[model samples]
Target: MKGVVISMIVVLAMIQFMVKPGQAISCGQVDASLAPCVPYLTGGGNPAPACCDGVKNIKGMAATTADRRAACNCVKDAANRYSNLKDDAAQALPAKCGVQMNIPISKSTNCDVIN
Candidate 1:
């Protein structure tokens, strides 16, 4: 019984790290040429026009190349810059929702792609 209880607790703890918020924050208001794009994955209000534009633009950039690695890199870069992703959410975002955020890495690269 003791071992079973301990195992359950460990599993639940691991599960917590797997959870992520619905959305991310955006980078519209900021300078575009520098950072270019930001994510509004935090899910509070509708992302600003610029935010949406940036994402579209990044997506376009990624599509242009067959590698598409840039798209994932862009998303990861954006998440690190715009969103306050920390701890589990940050980790999970890169791992589970990397595509959603446009990043391909399964771990936080701590990239400063944005200026």
Candidate 2:
């Protein structure tokens, strides 16, 4: 009985370390943060100050690989909804907003591959 209890405790401890932490950001949060940038992404114009703020907010929110992947997936979904999204403009958005994204913002990017 003593050995069985000890083994169970060890297994539980190992499981704790094996579990990945949940992402801090949600898809809804990602959408809210990036919504301000839609105009610049679809049309040719400088990104608004609010848009840049949103970009910076997203960059700050994505602190882990899981968070980045979630954000990437959200961005891809949003991009897919916009038929007029300019690829070049979308790609340049981060830089234009003075934010550096770890993951590429495009429909083609595989969110699962991001680490």
Candidate 3:
């Protein structure tokens, strides 16, 4: 069971590396870029400079519609990993970081809506 769980984690982690169709960014990039946003997104503290930097980085990575939606899904999945993650704060991070997200950051955001 333990090995199975670890394998599943590895698979999910690798999922971000697979670029399908017109996707411009990978989920791995999204994960790394948003690592600094945990405190603000989880409501543990205000957005730090590093967090804003990460937001800016994500803005650059998600350059295409497929990439934006992929990043959104990645972010949503990451947030869902945290039980206390706040939807409002997650939605507000982009604007707060001086970046505007083409797709909203809510967990309910449909990645397929990019078209």
Candidate 4:
């Protein structure tokens, strides 16, 4: 019985290494996808086809809650990187792209508020 328990413990430890738990998707994916939307998000122009495509891509990538939160944080950071971002314009990208985001994408948005 003791040998069996030891073997089980070893197997569990190996499994832990193989499958890292709580590994949220990289925020870089979100950043890359949304890069094209910067001009529109900053109120410089209407969202282009590429910008809308990025929004769709990001929306599809952020499937899990953790991924969504990470995406929200990344997008918020990206938004802050801009100089003259209009809040309404930033908020309207999702609608323009026909992709609804679980987490709001804005410089002033609180990532913690997203699920």
Q: Candidate 3 — what's its lDDT?
A: 0.74
Model 3 worst lDDT window (10 residues): 12-21
For each candidate, give its TM-score against the true structure: 0.35, 0.77, 0.74, 0.73
| Candidate 1 lDDT by residue in tens digits, 10-50 | 56445434535332222221123113122324433334454
Q: What are the runs in model 2 whose C-alpha is more than 4 Å off? A: 1-23
The true-structure Cα RMSD of candidate 2 reads 14.8
lDDT of 3 by residue, 43-94 (tens): 7457899788878877877787777777888877877788888888888888
Candidate order by decreasing lDDT: 2, 3, 4, 1
Sorted by TM-score (best first), the order is 2, 3, 4, 1
Off by over 4 Å in 1: 1-43, 64-67, 81-83, 86-115
TM-score of model 3 vs. true structure: 0.74
Better of 1 and 3 by TM-score: 3
Candidate 4 C-alpha error for residue 35, in Å: 1.1
Winner by TM-score: 2
The per-candidate count of clashes, in order, stands at: 10, 0, 0, 0
Of the two candidates 1 and 4, the one with more favorable lDDT, higher being better, is 4
